[model samples]
Target: MNTPTRTVPGQFTIVLHSHLPWLANHGRWPVGEEWLYQSWAGSYLRVVAMLRRLAEDGATDQLSLGVTPVLAAQLDDPHCAASMYEWLADWQLRATDAATAPDPTRRELGVREFQSAAAAIADFEMHWRHGASPQIRSLASAGVMEILGGPLAHPFAPLLDPRVRQFSLREGLADARGRWARQPAGIWAPECGFAPGMELDYATNGVEHFMVDGPTLRGDTALGRPVGDTDVVAFGRDLTISYRVWSPKSGYPGHPMYRDFHTYDHLTGLKPARVTGRSVSSADKKPYDPQRADHVIDRHVDDFVDHVRRRLISESERIGRPALVVAAFDTELFGHWWHEGPIWLERVLRRLPEAGVRVGTLATARRDGYVGAPVDLPASSWGSGKDWRVWNGPQVEHLVRLNAEVTETALEAVDKLVDPAGPRHPSGYRGGRSRVADQIVRETLLTVSSDWPFMVSKDTAAHYAVDRAHKHAHATREICDAALRGRAGLAERLAHNWSQADNLFAGLDARRLYTAALPSDTGS
Candidate 1:
């Protein structure tokens, strides 16, 4: 926990955003609940283990971890928690099956998979059986890292209705507080999406800072800047240093010795091949050798440490001050997408401090006076072209229009049906606290998740993405129609039925949608 001073040259911050849409009851293989379980076992389990080891050695401010509310809910959900344990058990069985195979290569692969699965199962029973909340909370409590919260469903706030945006942000932070015992002062901003006045929404919600792409700050990422006239700082990602590890065309994971992510052995659902060459066919790929990969990982770790040290020194010299370089990436990229990622992460984190480069979290940067004067950030994202094109581009124009329509319809219905008085249930319901309005708001929020359109535009699981988007949109419309038509009985029934699968934040009070008004609404 050594603080970087004038003699330290500069500081480096690692931000890993852990997110996946509500995928619990959705499809399983290729792209649904499987995504949740894989990331949980591969990235979450391994990453947290690494952090615990570091913390045991008295490391603080290791990194900033962003767990979106939707993902947090799933991680803590009883159904998902139980299902994840079952998934780990099944993985052990599969590894055993692979171990008994006739081929020596398959036997070797099976042995490796079995050992990994065994470790994962032991870890799950000991720490993750209840859910991920306790583990994440422990890390934050230990001061090992800062936790960043985001909107309820990881929506693209820049395109959402102003009222809905405000509601989502407030409810999101509340959800975090419920899970972790404290609401985060900083957020990942759901894809780093930002618009001209979103800073006001952030400031109103007690957010002291947030993340954005380097281009949003016009490449002045050496220091976080206050957006517009607000005190809410926007820390931009240093893509130069980040891309050195992983990028579109090149990265350490693409090395020929590393395990191949794409080539899977259909029989055992295991990846037994090494990334022999980018253009190499699956049949021609080399068998993965952990020994060789371990050597390469060590080399890559040294290379990355050197890169960060050089970047810090050069950026500090260029800025004429001790600069801050923030490298952010999706948490799933480690262990899940890149099998050797957790190992490399541990090595780099340990190596940087010894290499005379200070490593800390984003919160540390802001508090330690690494911030500069205010800069009005522009409309931008970390997506392709560093703009909103990936989420709102021509390919997904239909979704943009659909989100607007559904948001407006849901808002109108809530306005008409919900009681303005301080009550859990709306005006007409006398039985008890009704959840019809809550379900409506929930469906509407799911419809606008940035993941849907991003999937379609990327053409990865496009059909599934389209189906999920329309499914939620239809639920919103039907429930809103029923409630508006005074069919309270039918509306309540629909809400209850949909709640079976769409449920996540059980404490979400729909009244907040109307009660939490932005400053502009009151003309303050």
Candidate 2:
């Protein structure tokens, strides 16, 4: 279909799920702090800049951006801010080194890298020294994007103990508020994982909406649906649109002109090659050219805008109502994985409006009357085959058992510390617990993060994931052991050591794990 000649009968929403595991002092190089810094330099910094540009152009609430609490903690952490500055400066120096290399192609790439690094350093010095929270806060305050919260540590909620799941959700929202200065009304549930009854927890926590996979709605995802009689709305990712940009087989990032994410120049620690071809060896890949990438981006933007226009027009007609098409993806896909992603994103957001395709945040779509009947959703995720296998399959069953044991151990230890007759608050945190309980809870959430199993199953940095899970698990077990045996001094020391090693959530209150109605009950 051509560009619309009449008013469209549908709304389009782009939801970018932003998350990274708690990577502050974890490790570096292939995993840990390096991963965080690369994503920050490549994606977050550029995306935030793009949002600000859009806001300056009078755009408001253009998309839903989910920032997980763990990531927020890292972004706002003072040490990460300082270390990231040093990392960026190091990157610039490496580029300078490459610029003098003997190879002409290497020198050309060095020039591009130098420019990017220089600008990033400038941006970091001006806005990021104080931490990422303020910049993110400003974007939300300006209504430039709808912020979506996820459970603390991005846990796989379906497998979590019921009360622990609720606690994570509650604490995650609290984390977001503490950092962003506002509570998100919606969440991009970690991995878009959902089971039946999760909506009830979301509703109780004041969440207005959350996202699920398209199949969760049984392929009829033209509109948001309330799940199981809750006022909380569940939107599904329209994969037809999302896959056009990212998929395993064919996606925009696979384009020959785009920078090859895998082909790095070790001398400078910079990516110097274009994809060239999927089957081509890295040594044979062509050098990346920014000008060529820009040309491809312009074409892709127009094509994408047209695709959205056509889909909305067709879907609205098929459903016989004003449809809501939500395209959701990982925010890191843009600049981190696909180097030209942020530019393409900026172009798409700008061009969609001019192309007569309406663009707004998920909340705006709902508020402007995009509603549907209640749906009883089955278990689902946006993972492999849209099922739970990636997180809970035979391949990662050991992690499943480990998570269960650690969760039980931590919760039981904390439950023993709660006072039965203390002044009770609605949030279950009124009665305080020992600092050991607080430390164990923090370790518990970190152990349950879905990243471990996912990395294991995908074999993408599997060792790092396993090491991290074991590290947190060991810390929790040691802390629990100390607390159970009445070794208060040892418990305090262990907690302090763990806190120094893997501290992310400073405001996490372990008391929140206790259910208010039944103070003694910790979920079985």
lDDT of each: 0.89, 0.87
- Positional deviation of residue 384's Cα in model 2 after best superposition, in angstroms: 0.9
Candidate 1's C-alpha runs over 4 A off are: 1-8, 421-433, 517-524
List RMSD in Å for every model shown: 3.8, 3.9
User: Candidate 2, which segments miss by more than 4 Å at Cα?
Assistant: 1-5, 419-431, 515-524
Of candidate 2, the 10-residue stretch with the lowest lDDT total is: 515-524
* Local accuracy of candidate 1 as per-residue lDDT tens digits, 1-524: 97653335878999999999999898999889999999999899999999999988999999999999999999999999899999998998888999999999999999999999999999889988788889988999999999999988999999999888888898888888888988898999998998899999889889998999988888889999988889999999998988987785788889999999999999989899999999999999999999999999999988888788788888999999999999999999999999999999999999888878898888889899999998888889989898899999999999999999999998877766665643333437432344888888999999999999999999999999999999999999999888878788899899999999898888776666656542222110
Which residue pairs in candidate 1 have backbone atoms (N, alpha carbon, C) closer than 3 angstroms, thus clashing?
A: none
Pairing residues by index, what is the TM-score of model 1? Answer: 0.95
